[model samples]
Target: MTSTAREAELLPAEDAATYAEWFACLAEPTRVRLLQAVAVAGSKSVGELTEQLGISQSTCSHHVRKLAEVGFVALNKQGTTTRVSINPACCTGLPHAADAVMGVLAPRPCCPDNLACDVTVRPLEAGDWSAVRRIYAEGIATGNATFETEVPTRRALESKWLPGHRWVAELEGEIAGWAAASQVSNRTCYAGVAETSVYVGDAFRERGVGKALLHKQVTAADTDGLWTLQTSIFPENRASLALHHSAGFRTVGFRERIAKHRGIWRDTVLLERRRSVESPE
Candidate 1:
């Protein structure tokens, strides 16, 4: 680990209690199930959660209240029924908190993700899978770009990526690059808080294709109610680091030897950009 990465390992005294409280709130298995249920199934009444989770109404209500107290979920009363939903902000905040505690990242100062092609940016459609994967394979060919030695299957990418946030760029008529976001967590409160990936084809490098694709990705995320975006990059990939920096991402610090690529341990710089303005939606 480098000096910055080593120095970052200690948890700050001031934040200790807050992180502890956040973790404690989900200590119960029932509460965990409730959060996953709300996240996957959307907002639900206490009665609905009770039936879905196979718990009694009173028990369901009690756990929901507990989660709400720590900002994990929110409850709204509609006449006789109380609807429980995941907190939009906490969707990103809690995971960021955990990463900070583990010395893998720094606390937010505040935030913001993007790309291009003839250069046109549009939502990626089913027909674009081959092009997207081709671009992905090209990116993987660059040793510093990603850890994957082989391109992931389209079905694999589809299952891992969030819908609506996937985008592709075209130059003239050829797909030149792609960008997509993946869920950072399966927990309900973290819904829509995503980690982004942008890959440009070898032919499109340095052609402003990335910038165009990124613009579409972040704009779509904002309109879709995402408030935070995170990405990991190898320090050696200076162009990518610069692009993200220009897009408003701040370095959280080096996640030293975080993982292995090609049998060699690789260090990655963790970066996150929280939206400067909260999503109005």
Candidate 2:
């Protein structure tokens, strides 16, 4: 490993104290169980937790207190009764803390270097829309892509996606996959942040099309001054998640019951990749 990797593997001294506190809070199995129960049930009264956990009211309350002290759970008091809920922020913060300590979120390459030479990734062109939309339809049919039951029109996508950031991967002169970034917000403060999307054609499934498209997409975003790129993917889409991870994305957290798809509620894993400051513009 390089010196940079060595430095990243060692959790910084300033962060060690706080990370230790968070870990120590869950050192007890009962405390860990208490946090999990509250997290799953949303918000529950102490009595509800006690009965579900099969512990005495005092024991439940004691563990809850410990979790609350570490900012894992938030307690709301109401007329002699207290309801405990998992902190929404901690859902993402805890995982980020773990990644930081383990060095999984350390600075990495701007994009994958070993890209398939035969697959050509280039900026979107007028002729690429048909193929791109077709690939997107394939992803939607899988029922794990997005909540939208129908593919958006090319005009709609053109308006939403950043012009220079849109790209398509071609194999043997045929579009195999496409990737693009959409601005997350119109506000000036968030101009540097974007939400990304990538879809690969059915025929191109294991040919590194997804990887090539992501490498081009992320590298373009980083060079264009975009500091943050994020995406929410279905938990069942393991291939997409693995592709993004290889491109430097880290799991920030999981959003449970984020939306409904085909009349059934679905959850999504939120992942993000922040541009490394050391990377050249």
Candidate 3:
């Protein structure tokens, strides 16, 4: 066992008093292993857990039962197999559990070595057209963002983006990402609403570029008196979902087969961030 595993074993004892049942349940090596497996799989059945961990079916069931007893795992009957998944509430309440577990299991950040570059959020500039085109080109190639046929020309895009609420993220003095809000509908009734979009260069993604762009767009829209800003994100794009949620966007609906890409239909989720009831001065 590595030092981390050894530490995991002993650390639970410190909180044993308040979490006696949980600690005691996790004390068993087999139960701990089962919990780890379930956490990794998101949700798993008894048989699937046994196969993944290379443990006996009966032993897997026993350890899973222990985990469930302590509230670390929840079991659901799925036909002949029992499906088990981590109880997020239980793990979240246990101090340091998330950090310790994720440190050992989660993938490292993509841009871990690039500390010198800082992402900057600011209003879009007059000459940011080239950078905006480059960002849009990258997003277009990915096939996950936007339905535009090709990167819009600088003059055309700037005419549309510059006049309305917009923001861009600069990385090391280069425009790496951009987001903007446009009127949702031309009718005067929808004047207080806008649809928002964000695009980031592939190289700068997962480096806080998207969030920075989104922050600027949201702030700019709020400042411009847009009461509600909305966006539709592809269901598979987890990063976009996280960005919108962090920016206070609430999921309002899901549209199935709203768009097609590469001969397949894509489902888009609608999200909106409303200006707080308290107005921005």
Candidate 4:
């Protein structure tokens, strides 16, 4: 663990024990299959579970009971049939537990306070496309910034980014950098999770423009109800990695040669920040 991990909170022993129990309870392949079926099709009678999963009724009932014991599934009795439904909390709880076990959680400040004094961060505007593309082109030109060989078209970017999460930084009235977060998935289960990207113009590197943009981006995400933000950077991009770390992102993994760029395979350092979101459940 780095100083950051020492400074950051670790998963509590009790929580870890509970997560272990949850994990252990689903260790059987049949139970995993049963849980998936219930989650996908809403409530299911034991007969429906048995038929859909092609298992015997006794086996289905046994596995459903195991899942219920760990609170992963709920059982209801309607008439003589027992209806099994996935727990609403499991939608969030399972992913959170995985993050906890992997030590990918980030309980940090809303944003870094040491934001660039000379930079002003603001919501991206329609007319900012020209400058935004120019800055994006700068990032694309740096082969290490992304796997993209060319800057994305404005329409393409606009459609991809979450509307309110797009932001830009102005240094001396010029666009110096930009930051945005996009949905990690369209599924409702992952509605509050996003993948983040920060790009600083080449000339603005080391001027704190990246941090300034990130300060606004992350804090806005927290206020806007994002629970987790993640990004991947090439291992060689130390400056970008440092800027993200200042914003409290932790390296979750080192993806070995995860993709190719310019005919060469490249490794990426996966980083993530988890904002503690209040659960309606």
Which is the leading candidate under lDDT?
2
lDDT of 3 by residue, 42-111 (tens): 8988888888889899988888887887688899997887899889886566544533433422222211
Clashes of each: 18, 0, 0, 0
lDDT (C-alpha) at residue 171 in model 1: 91
What clash pairs does model 4 have? none
Which lDDT tens digits does candidate 4 get at residues 99-205? Answer: 77775564656557877689998899988889899988888887889999888898899899999999989998888888999999999999989999999888888
Ranking by TM-score: 2, 4, 1, 3
Whole-model Cα lDDT of every candidate shown, in order: 0.83, 0.89, 0.75, 0.87
lDDT of 3 at 227: 86
> How far is 278's C-alpha from truth in model 2 (Å)?
2.5
Stretches of candidate 2 off by over 4 Å are 1-8, 13-21, 33-94
* Candidate 3 ranges with C-alpha deviation above 4 Å: 1-117, 162-164
- Candidate 4 segments exceeding 4 Å error: 1-107, 277-281
TM-score of each: 0.59, 0.77, 0.56, 0.63
TM-score of decoy 3: 0.56
Query: Which prediction has more favorable TM-score, 2 or 4?
Result: 2
Best by TM-score: 2
lDDT (10s digit) by residue, model 2, range 60-160: 99989989998999999999999999999888878878888777877677567888889999999998889989999999999988888999999999999
Clashing pairs in 2: none
User: How high a TM-score does candidate 2 get?
Assistant: 0.77
Q: How accurate is candidate 3 locally (lDDT)?
A: 0.75
